[model samples]
Target: MQQTIEALRVALNKKRWHEARYALSRARALTNALPADVAVQEREQLSALRRMYAARNTPTAKKAQQAKSKAVGRAGGKKPAAKKSTAKSAAQTPKPAPVRDLGDRFINRANLGYGPTNEAKGSRTR
Candidate 1:
């Protein structure tokens, strides 16, 4: 019974009207098996679910959802063109300095994997 109520709440929160209605019906069917006091509480919850289901299926709600979808271009409505901003330009900034390669220096110091030696392979004289 608790699980049924929880499932109904989850379905309602997710706006799954059919699933919520199904769960509500299940709750109603089990209410007869419960004690009178608990059954009354379950009946109140079922009534609230019924109200929510009706509200979500109302004509006004449907129209509002349709208008929202149309505004968002999901209902075949024409979307407004995006405006371009030209305040920032690439030519306004200065170019950065190029990077220098120092891998050859390490290679020369390591003497081509033969370990450190006195063999000067690079521009060590300069």
Candidate 2:
């Protein structure tokens, strides 16, 4: 119960959607303490908490907004970028970072050898 509440609260603070939901689910599972009307309140509280946490991390958010602006600028779309401020951008969804695949190399030793001697070199019976 206490563990569930704490986990849920942390998730709420982090803007982690699943965590907040899990917390609410676990809280209900543990105690079912909330009134039907209070569920909406709980969600709003979580949203405010996430907003506050994001505001505190605005510098990082600003850097990302600037980078996105640069990308748009390079693309040179006729649809000019809106001059909306940083606060608005921060409230928007965070963009997924571009992924660079360095290669899918692996040392798969499981199917390397097959003979009795190979098995012997691998593991011994107790």
Collision pairs in model 2: none
Expressed as tens digits, the lDDT of each residue in 3-77 for candidate 1 is 898899899878887899899789878987777787676678777876876788789978987998777644556
lDDT of 1 at 24: 78
Give a tens-digit lDDT track for model 2, residues 1-126: 456656877776576877676666666664456565656755565455546444544797668767987775534457766885989888999999999996655433544654343354555332
Give per-residue lDDT, candidate 2, residue 73. Answer: 57
Candidate number with greatest TM-score: 1
**Reference-based TM-score, model 2:** 0.27
- Where does candidate 2 stray beyond 4 Å? 33-126
- Clashing residue pairs, backbone N/CA/C < 3 A, model 1: none
Question: What are the Cα lDDT values of the candidates?
Answer: 0.75, 0.62
